[model samples]
Target: MTTTRICVDPVTRIEGHLRIDCDIRDGQVVDAWSSGQMWRGIETILTGRDPRDAWLYTQRICGVCTTVHAIASVRAVEDALALEIPLNAQLIRNLIVAAHGIHDHLVHFYHLSALDWVDVVSALKADPMATERLAQGLSDWPNNNARYFAEVQSRVGKFVASGQLGIFAHGYWGHAAMRLPPEANLMAVAHYLEAMDYQRKSNQITAILGGKTPHIQNLAVGGVANAINPDEQSALNMERLAYLKTLMDELQGFVRRVYLPDVIVIAALYADWLPYGAGVMNYLSVPDFPRDTKGTDFGMPGGYIPAADLTQFHAVKHFGDPYFEQNVKESIKHSWYKGDWTRSPYDGETVPEYTDFQQDAAYSWVKSPSFADEPAQVGPLANVLAGVASGHAGTIGYLNTALERIGAITGSPVPMAALHSSLGRHLARCVRTQVLYDMMVENYQALVANIAAGDTTSFNPPTFPKGEQMGYGFHEAPRGVLSHWVVIENGKIKNYQAVVPSTWNAGPRNQNDARGPYEASLIGNPILEEERPLEVLRTVHSFDPCLACAIHLHDNARQTIVRVNAF
Candidate 1:
């Protein structure tokens, strides 16, 4: 069989530059390489910085994933000092986390990855009334009317006529792999435009709580900087809380009525894609939304499920669980780093050595991260599966509801095992979003009740000891499990390493020379057209790749760089 090597240089619509190389044999990807075409030296930048101020710098690692990194940084410092923050702080932080997650998932589906499955040009051929009928049958969202869809269609038509698709440009329109009908395409496009508004509303909650969106201003070592006083307008008072509830209500409605339903409909329509993209099934996620100050109890459950087997689940109990710390290691063998050894994050080093795109050797800048000496996939799918394995009621309830809806659409029962595929990742993300909505409401109420009880404290000052201490903090971020490891020496950061979600999923071969999740998932994925690999984008986009978190840009010359392309 003749194999064709295809190179998708700098996969667009993602956070950072990522080059995906695949070998196509008989229209199927037989082998693949996932490479992060950048380097992130944030770990080395914090060499001798103050531990308390570490969160501020770390949050800048990625503009999109700022809040998660901020939260993880502070938690790491707190864990190292064994500090417990106030309950009010915990609740406030939870709200920020949930809101950020909701906003991220919304934008990812509608704005980023939706174009892979939805054909914008085909929507131009759709009947507005037919699209309205299809949308109304799925959900009672108020905008599901012919007039509204017609207006949306007109707006899109203008963009097309102007020859400036803008965000909709560069799409593989009319591709053979695009399976949706014209009406369905129009409906998805309509929802895609509406999603922009709701995602902003979700971010408002984060801005209100965290003082900003990209790089939140409220996080501290011990707790959040948000003061509480119902009578004071400047503090986190009743009026702000009420406003937040209103935003939450709007977001929850969209998630239930629009976002969740949209994903389910798309998944059902693309049911044939359900069997592909389930690779490196060793799942790993960490417990988040802490209910207590010591970081022991959580509203959401997270653990490890090895080899796609739910029965072999192992929960990482607390803040500094030896189970997690002892097993986490990063191998630089296939990465563009100085070392060739697999070392724990505590002893991790990030010295760059650029050896451009060596397929048989070092290729990616992302270090291969492993758990228990194996590549474990991390993301919403991992979070949902871990929750289901741990018997969490909220996760189970939402999972069953989504499965039933998909099954109803397909005229058959969707088994739990089916969730181990591409469409399953999309479904699992929706399930996680629904559960997160409930968590947001619960945390909001808890914050109100606590404040009503006259407990308004949100911060607890930290006192670092005069010695070296190492600690790790893990958060089940929007992408997956994001952890920050810190070695603090006399109040200064000795060493810092962030094993981000993308690092786990988008990495190169591990120490055992095993393909990472992204590379492995691409195997067996069909490439309908050699020149235009729309099928390739469908599976890769399912993971919501954020290479910015996995790698970073380092250009010391400060020169303008441009690459012209002829498509």
Candidate 2:
């Protein structure tokens, strides 16, 4: 058998720099490697900084998930102090998280990964009226009209006729793998534009409560800085709350009617993908959206599943659970770091020793993160599986709805087990979005009700003691389980580390040579074309790879570049 090496450098349509190398044999990927081309050293920058200011700095780690890092950092400090935030603070943070997730997931599916399945060139050939009818059949979204689709089709036609593909430049436009019909492609193209408006509305929810998007300003050590006064005009007043509710309403409508239907339709069209991209079956996710101030009860459940065996599942009862904390370690065996030993994240070190890519040696900047001595995948799919396995009502309801819809479209009963593939990751995101839409509304109502009952407190001041103290914060973010570990000594951050979602999924092999989720998923994937590795991109994008968050950026002093594009 002749083996060929296919290298995809700077994988497009993702956050940071990544290069995927796969060895193809007999037209299928026999082996693969996921490399983070840049090294992220944000953790090293946090040494000797004020613990309270860590969130502001750490959030800069990724422009895409700024709010998530901010929330996680503050929560870690609060955990170290053993502080309990006020209920209003809890509600406010929950709303920000839910809203950010809505925006992130929406942009991820439509803007980042949709083109992998949607054919823009084909869409130009679709009849505008037929596309409108297709959209109407999928959902009752009011944008389902002949005029709206015609406008979208015309825009697409102009883009193609201009001979400038722009973002669509490197796409496998006419690949044999492209399966969707021209009419379906047109419908997706229309929703893709409308998604931009919906995502903006979702971001407004974050901005209203957090004072800004990307990086929020309201988070403090103990709680949020958002003032809660029902009548006060300058603070978080009733008027602002009403406006927030309106934004939430619009966002929810888009997710339910537009986003959910699109995912189901796409999944149905590519039902053959159900068996591929089933990477490391082991899953991990932490509970999010605390219902109380102490973070005791959660709106979402978290747990671990080793080897895809749901029967041997273990629930993560609370923050800093022994099973999670003690078992979490980062191995530098295949990373461009000094050490080869796997140590707990609290004691983790990031000493860079860069050497050009070596297939058998260090290849990535991301340290392999393992839970319970095993590589586990963390993301929406993990969260959904954990919730469904643990019988969490919200997760169960959402999963059922997604399975039923996908099944109805494919003319077959989509079992729960089918949710272990590339399509499953996409479906899980839509399911998680549905659960978050309701959670956003529920948390918002709780905030209003609490304020009406003469309780307007939002922040609780946190105090740090002398000597060394260490703690961790966990959140089931839009991508999956995101945790920040902190070591505070005498009111300063002694050390800091963030085990981000991308790190878990895109990291390299461990000490035992066990492949990471991205590498493992590509093992048996059919490479339809060597030059156009659309199948590889589909699997990688399914993880929504954000190497910027997983590994820090590379700053080059001599290079000056400017990008300008017309959409």
Candidate 3:
């Protein structure tokens, strides 16, 4: 049995740099390692800075997850200062989160992960009429006509004819893992382009609510900075709210009729994937989209599921629950850090001790974040499952709807347990998106109604204490549960650490050599072609690994000095 080492360095289409190393034997991955190849010392920079301004700096951690970090940062400061945000601010922030979630989910599926399963080259062979029929059967998407598909096919044909695959390059197009039919591929490709427009619309909604994109400027320590006035044009007024409503409606339609159906179609076609990529069964999710100012009532539920057992699940009722706060610890045992001790995030340190990559030693820049000394998968699947366990009506409804559609497509039952795999991650994202769309409308209406009731306040300026105070902010970000831990001393930041989603999913082995989610998921995956390694990409991409958010940046202007030796 010859064991071969396969390295897919700099996995394309993801936000930042990541490398996957797998030991393949008998055409199956026997062992694997997930490496985040850059160092992001955002926490270090936040030290000694005003806690209020930490959000502005931490938000720059990643271009994709900027809004999430900003929100989390402010919440952390607010938590430390015991600041209570206004009703209007809570609602406004919820809207921004929902909009960002929709945009990020769509981008992940259509732009980043779809090509892993979709055969773009085969799409050129798809019959436009058949593709149109397929599209209509799936959803009432308006662009399902033969002419539209034909146009998409023609564009793809020219792209293929030019021999410049452009974005489609470096993909294993004709591999055995490309299970989707030509018509399915064509439909996915078409929706992929449609998603770009919808993505922009989601961003537009965020801009309206947050006053800008990428790094939103409206968020303050206690709440948001948006001035609510019904008749004023410069404020979050009637006209802006009306325009925002239109964008939400359009995005909701696309999610319901297009994105959800596409995920189901792909899942049904690749049903074999249901058995693989079921990484660590333990999951974590945080409650988000607070419906009330006190945050006692939430639009989405949060909890911890140990070993995928709904029976043993524990729900996190509010922000900074002891169940969450006390259990979360970051281990630098197998990371590029100076210490081997597992410390809580409140006391977490990010002292970098760079060593050359070692297979059995430090291999990644991401510190191993564990819940109760155990590695848990965190993301859409976790959030959805946690919601299901906690009897969240929206989660149950959307999940049932998704499972029913998948069952109908596959002509069999796709159980709730099926959500533990790669296909399930995609389906769970669609389910979560559906739930968020409903909540988006609900929050928007609440915000509008609040302003009409003559309460236009959106912020509560925080007053810091004299001594040191520690607090962490939690957000159910697009990736998963993101927490920013900060210790404030004399109104300035003393210590800062971010236990991001990617760190939970993509970090290296902990003190016990326990694999992270990405490594565990790749253990039994079938490597159809070692060189192409499409199966590996599918599993990794399912996690939506954002190394840019996990590890920091490197100088791309300088040439990498490492030499490659081919065997």
Candidate 4:
């Protein structure tokens, strides 16, 4: 067998740069490696800076999850100081997070990820009336109808007219995998544009509470810097909620009408995809959505899952909480970290020691993160399963409805174990949306009632009781589990490390040669061509690779060479 290599550096349309290398043997990829080419210095940058400014700086780590990083960073400081933010502060934080989750999902699915499955050019051949039938039959509001469809047609016409198909010039309509008849693609195409506009509105809610986005301000260590009075709380206005409800309504309908069916249509055409990308069964979810306990409001507590029994079918085998350090450890065996060995997150360090990208040697800068010493997977699918298995009411109902919808389309059940691919990623976002929306209502009511309950203030930065201690603050963000650990001495940051979702999913193989979530998922895909490795793209994109947080997509602050066997 002759081997051919395909390398696409700077994976386009994502937030950061990536290098996807595929080893093709007989027209199929026998092995694949994903390299994120940047080094994030957020932690290094915050070392001597005011610990108070940590949240403000850390939020810049990723444009997509800025709100999540800010919240996690501040909560880390608050945990270290043993500070209890006021009820109002918790509610405000909850709102910002939920808004971020909802808006981020809408935008990511429609704008960045949908093109993988939905062919825009093929949509031109779709019968508008059939698309209407799909839209009208759903319980939600109609998707972008005739007028909106016309607008998209004109817009796409302008793009093609401009001779700037750019990346889209090579239409995939003739590909065997392209099976969605025109109208369904048209509906999806229209909503992709509509989702963008609606997502911006939801993001505005975060800005009103936290400041601006791509990164927000005032999401400080001891709760919000901006105070919310009755007027301000009420300023959340029914209009904003209405916008979310409408947009989400359309999204759910489109998922049921356009996306889900599209998945089935494509899957039927490419039945081989069913088994190629299943990675480790280990899964994790950080509890999000604000829940009240003992007069304390906690954003959903973080949690995890392990491969214990297959009969139970995606059941939670193990549970973990805020003390995430016990559950997470990183192995530098195949990464650039020149450490003694795999170290606990609390005791972790990131010093990139570059050797070479040899299979038997160092391949990625991403350290291998394991859960309870296993390669735990994190992402949308994990989020949905954990939410449902944990018995969150909103999540259970959301998942049940999705099962019924997919069942109707497939004429059979989509077993829980299948939550590991293009289908799982999309479904997880819907489940997360439902979960955060429910929390938004619950949290909004709490803030309103707190004021009426005669506690006019929701923030009280208690005088820090002195002690040498450390703590972990963890919660689920839209992408997956997010956590931060901090050790403080003399009211300054002594030791700090963060295990963001991207790191968990994009990490390298461990000493045992166990693959990180994305790498493992990429290993078994069909390559078709050495020059165009679309299958590997499908597998890696299914994980929604976030290179900024992983910081391995070519934006090194400064490169230095250190001699180490691991590097």
Candidate 5:
């Protein structure tokens, strides 16, 4: 058997720099490597800074998922001080998280990864009437009209005729692996354009509550910086609450009538992808959306599910869960770091020691994070599985609906085991989005009711003690389980480390030399064309790799930071 090496440097349509290398044998990937091509040193920058101001700095780690870091940072500091957040503050934070997550998931599916599955060039051959009929049969979305699809087709045709495809320029158009019919392609392309407007509406919910979207200004050490005054003009008044409800209504409508159904249709069309990309199946997620001050109660349940078995789920119940903290360790053995020790994030170190891509040695800047002495996958799949295992009604309900819809489309009952594949990840994300929308509405109503009861508190002051304190905060972020570990010595940050979601998925090899999630997921993935490995991207993009969260650094000197070695 002849083996060929394929390298995709700086994988497009993602957040940061990532390089993927695969060895193809007999038209299938036999071995793979995932490398984070940059170094993120936010932890080092947080050292010696005021612990109260950590959220402001940590939130700047990634431009896309800024709100997640901010929420996690505040929770970590509050946990360290043993502070209890006000109910209003908790509800407000929950709203921000839920909105941001919905927005992020929408953008990821329609804008980022959808192109890997939908072919734009083929849409030009579609008949407007056929496309409209296809979309209408799937969902009763108002835009499923022949004239509207024809208008979209004309706009896309103009892009093609102008000799500039803009965003659609570099796609693997007309590839043999592209299997959607021309009518289905046209429908998907139309939705791709309309998704931009709906996603913005979802993001507006975050901006309204958090003061801004990219880096929210509402987070503080003990509680949110938002003031609660029902009648006052400048504070959280009824008018603003009503506006939030309106945004939630529009977002929920689009998600249910368009986003969820679109994903199910695409999953049914690409059902062949359902058996691939089930890598590093030990799943880990953390409970979020706290209902009380101490963080013991949650709106969504989370835990560890080993080997995709929901029966073995172990729940992470609170803010500072020992099961989560003690078992989490990052190994730098195959990373471009100083040491080869597998230490907890509480004692983690980040010293750069670059060695150009050695296949069996140091390769990526992403440190392998192991949950309970083994590599575990994180993200919506993990979150949904854990929720189902814990008997969360909302998660189970949405998940079953999605499975049933796919089954109706494909003419076969989609089994639970199918969720361990690439299509499963996509379906799980949509299910999670539906659950999040319900949570958002519930939190909004709770906020309104609490305000009507004459309780208008939204902040709590904090005071650090005279001795050392250690605390860790975990949130089931948009990507997966995001944790911030802090070591405060007399009100100053002594050591800070963030075990981000991307680090858990895109990591190279673990301390035991086992391949990480991204690498392991590509093991049996079929590579139809060695030159244009579109199949390779479908599996990787399913994970929604965000290298900026795993590793990121900018050079002020503008010199070449590192050299790429082609295989």
Candidate 6:
């Protein structure tokens, strides 16, 4: 059998380090594996510490999504302590989660994942005038190149002239998947640069509120530590709100004016991609923005989209609520841990053994988190699906529109299967961004009214007076369903285990011989070359992986004695 090796020395524009390996045949990847060689033990480090301090330690797991981790940890601690935050606390927590959603989505689409699909080299030939027309046709916005797209043209020309297409190094330059005209590519390229600056400003909302980006300090179990009075609340009033509002506008603009159109453009070019790279039919999501009283009471605000073989969607319900208790569990059969191999998260246990590369000893510190004893796809797809199933206001309508768009592109109704690829993942993220923007607006209005009625305290620190209890805190983080399980004894952490978004998506095969989401998604992808494996990148980017947060290095030694003797 003839084989072509497809490889990517270093996947660019991702948060952490990983190299893609694929075994290819006939220009398609039939098999693939993602390798990460870095390791640090935050989980082990935090062992035996006070349960109250777990949030502080977890927040440092990753700099990019620290706030999300902190929120999960605090909520988990709160659950364990059986602490009910003040109403104001709920509102603040909601805002922090919302802010993280917006920031993470923007960063994913523009900075971390865009290059995989967008071609920087293509922009060099774009005719600026035509781009302006396309933008005008797409929407009526005041782009710096609104009336004229030439300003971008000049700079892009220089970058290309300099013979340094830094961002396009691994881009499938002439791949069949590229479809946007040079002009449209030009528009996207310019906005790609502009988005970097705009997204940074969007981050300030988190910075001012949380204390910093990547990880914030304002959130706690009881509620936010940062107090917001009338003046502090003013930050979300007109000016700050308007700035946030601008981001929404820009985000929508990019989706419509650039991202969607580019997707269609590429889809048209790679019609064959319509059938390949679909992973397991199982889909699971933990929704956000619950409107109903029942939905609110239980933190489970989303639905679980099962694999194709599974039946209808099921509500994940809140962590504190007893409703979603049926679906969550962790399996250790294939994992390194030797403790109870299979256990319900409600009684989950985490006892880390030292790092050993032996497949059984402990290949990765990440534990396998299964919903219904199976791996489930998380992230944008899960968010959208869960939101719709949870009776989230307007979710169905939004979904219908997305489905229609996918249908039109593929000439077949977009199946749940389509939601597993690079294009599907990117498109799903854009749709979710719109959903999050609206949710933030709704919460912002609610916060204003709550403050008007005379409630100001957003937190209520607890004493853990009883000094022993267990709490399960769950939320849909940027990556997917994130949960914290805590066991408190004498007010200190007796045991802890986290079912993070990445662990669900990135974990290895389970005891029953099942592939994780990433592995399954890589199946059927055509491997192109050993030197540049595009399929591995496809699956990796599809998850918008934040391995840095889930939390992976190298060693070279010198031999001096023999060398000195030879010399």
TM-score of every model versus the real structure: 0.98, 0.97, 0.97, 0.87, 0.98, 0.86
2 versus 4: better TM-score goes to: 2
Best by lDDT: 5
Among all windows of 10 consecutive residues in model 6, the one with the lowest summed lDDT is: 552-561
lDDT of 5 by residue, 326-379 (tens): 999999999999978999999999898999999899999999999999999999
What's model 3's TM-score?
Answer: 0.97
lDDT of 3 by residue, 420-522 (tens): 8988998998899888898899999998888889999888778887999988889999899999999999988899999999999998898678999999999
Whole-model lDDT, model 2: 0.90
Stretches of candidate 1 above 4 Å error?
555-567
**Roughly what TM-score does model 1 have, to 2 decimal places?**
0.98
Off by over 4 Å in 2: 554-567
lDDT per residue (tens digit) for residues 1-567 in model 2:
899999999998999999999999999999999999888888988989999999999889999999999988988888888889899999999999999999999999999999999988898888888888888988999988888888888887888899987656767888999989999999998888889999999999999899988789999988888887777898999999999988887787899999999999999889988899998999999988899988878888899988888777798877667777888888999999997889888999988988889879999998999998889999999999888888878878877887787788889999887889998999999999999988898899999999999998888888889999999998998988899999999999998999999999999998789999999999999888998999999999999988899999534453444456889
lDDT of each: 0.91, 0.90, 0.89, 0.66, 0.92, 0.64
lDDT of 6 by residue, 1-567 (tens): 686655554566666655454567776666544433344356555657877788888877777767777877877788766676777667656666776777787677767766655667787677677777765654455773544467776776676687876654446776555565777677777777776765665576667667777667777667777565665654433455456456645555554455445454454445556566567557776655534222255222566767643347776555476554556777765454556476776565545444544443345445566777777888877776666556655555655666675567567766655655656666667767666666666776776678777777777778776556877777788778787777777877777766777777766666565766766777777655445455567667868776665543111232342323453
True-structure Cα RMSD, model 5: 2.6
lDDT of 4 by residue, 369-485 (tens): 887788888877777766655565766786777666666666666665555665566666766676676677677677666766766555556344455557666667777877776
- Model 3 Cα displacement at 373 (Å)? 0.8
